[model samples]
Target: MLDQISRGAVGVLVVEDDAVTRKTLCLAIESAPELKLLTAFDSVKPALAWLETTRPDVLLTDLGLPDGSGIEIIHACTHRYPQTDIMVVTMSSDEANVLACIEAGASGYVLKDAGKMDIARAVLDLRAGGAPMSPTIARMVLAKVRDGKKPQAATFPTAGDTTSLTKREAAILDLIAQGDSYGEVAKLLSVSVGTVQTHIKNIYGKLAVHSRGEAVFEAHRRGLLKLGHPRSE
Candidate 1:
């Protein structure tokens, strides 16, 4: 895995259909000194073609492409180039599409309305092992967990093993499922934000999940935490 910060300039590939939106994203990426604009495409077909020979550090793509759904490209990059951080940059804030992209291996999701700078920062954040999500999208994910939607079965180690979460980690997961942000969780737990991030990283590893939504879902599925119940402080 590439250490995002250690790398001088990360290569970025963008796939969007709208001319204006695509241009806006390209310029935003160009403005970041740590990011390199590898290429931009208007459709999934050409994006897939480019992926066949080249691998980028980050992928910013729209979910609704003229040729086909950008989910295809997301899946392609994720499976083919496991190291690439894939993010969905689109207007779709609907739960279904958001969940679909998450399950398809997108590490981040950003709405086009987030403006160019937010989009650019999302890529950088993703490279830094952060799951950048629009506020609305983050709320949708928390709601999904609260609704008790069945999550995919755990593919990682089961509870009671060495890989199982420590009690503190489980508590952190409960807070996160309750829709607490990282900073909030840190304050509530009386720890630093960096400590919360470390626990979350371990939680993601044990849950075999890529995003916060998936982690919560998998935690629920594995009986790690009860849905709609936040742990008492």
Candidate 2:
């Protein structure tokens, strides 16, 4: 399967323990001509082994494997191949595991019940630098940020310290924390998508965060966002 991957295609690696689910994921990946099924593994061991030598453009992994948690695979890929976009395709949606996966460097999260087309679209979205999360997962993530326990003294900036975000940047962060996609944020802000992306890049730099979940968490931690309330233009 590795050798069969077409040149210049988006290589995809899937890790799922269930035979039926794994096959379904493979079929979904194969259905996209722009995507290539580099390989699929049923456990973390082979997936990690393959990852040591080869890095796929996208990784779609389930949280629970027969041998261990898939978060290990996510960590490994994120640490070793920062270019690879890691995604969680699992039935588990509990806050703990979901937060762990996001912290471990998963840019996308999708439930197993999502249709094949949704899954395919997620892959394409990730390749396009979007953080794609299922609607339920997105709400869970937002709730977690809103209700997060107060940070330790040293873990966050001091209360008197400013976040150094411009009004536009702060507004953008507010919309993002509200679970608005890039396109939606752009439309809401009356800006081009590329302009929204540039603002997000600046936001990440200022907050020292790399992913949407982290940015939201950091923004909430810094008290820069008023949860459940829309920002004025």
Candidate 3:
């Protein structure tokens, strides 16, 4: 399964100005079963140069680099390798950083303060097309939306295609749209409780909605799923 992933065999890139962090990030990525360490760079100059050539599956970048900001890397990634997922693993949990990264097409924003396992899970989630954001960062981003501010224009791909979901995720949504609980969906999908949570995360992003009900409504609006489909008990 890992080998079948695009550029998955080679693994992700780590870009941070801090030497210790660069090494730690590489080691952490290597620790994951599916993630192979590619190259660890300390600045945008080299990171961009390498990305122009060998596009990795995921990128762990810090917001502040000696040569440029991590946002520069995000722009470069989207412009060059749109398929590659960018995760900002940094110390800044500020709302501005959270909003800037997402607006620039960042796939996820994880705080360095999160657990090490959270970092590994985040990378895996990114590789599997999931948006893994830190709760703190998630709150910051949501706070802005709750305040009713329009998001700045960003260049995210139009997910009009139906391939945005896996078979299991789609199945789970079919149940969710009909009012299934996380535990019930997990049982139906034959996956663990945590797996169900991850599927819901992907569902929310794909549908551009925050909750199960919103996703169901959005999916109907997009004509991807029928509004009143019967769900099994």
Model 2 regions more than 4 Å off: 1-9, 113-117, 129-131, 149-155, 159-163, 228-233
| Alpha-carbon local distance difference test for all models | 0.78, 0.82, 0.69
lDDT of 3 at 189: 64
Winner on TM-score between 1 and 3 is 1
lDDT by residue for model 3 (136-228), tens: 766665455434322221223255555356657667777665445667667766788788778777877776554343455445444455333
lDDT of 2 by residue, 62-158 (tens): 9899999999999898778866888899988898999999887787889887654467778888776677888899888876775663552247677
Q: What is the TM-score ranking, best to worst?
A: 2, 1, 3
| Arranged by lDDT, best first | 2, 1, 3
lDDT of 1 by residue, 167-200 (tens): 7888888876665667777888899989988888
Clash-forming residue pairs, model 2 = none
| Candidates 1 and 2 compared by lDDT, better number | 2
By the TM-score metric, which is better: model 2 or model 3?
2
For candidate 2, the per-residue lDDT at 63 reads 89
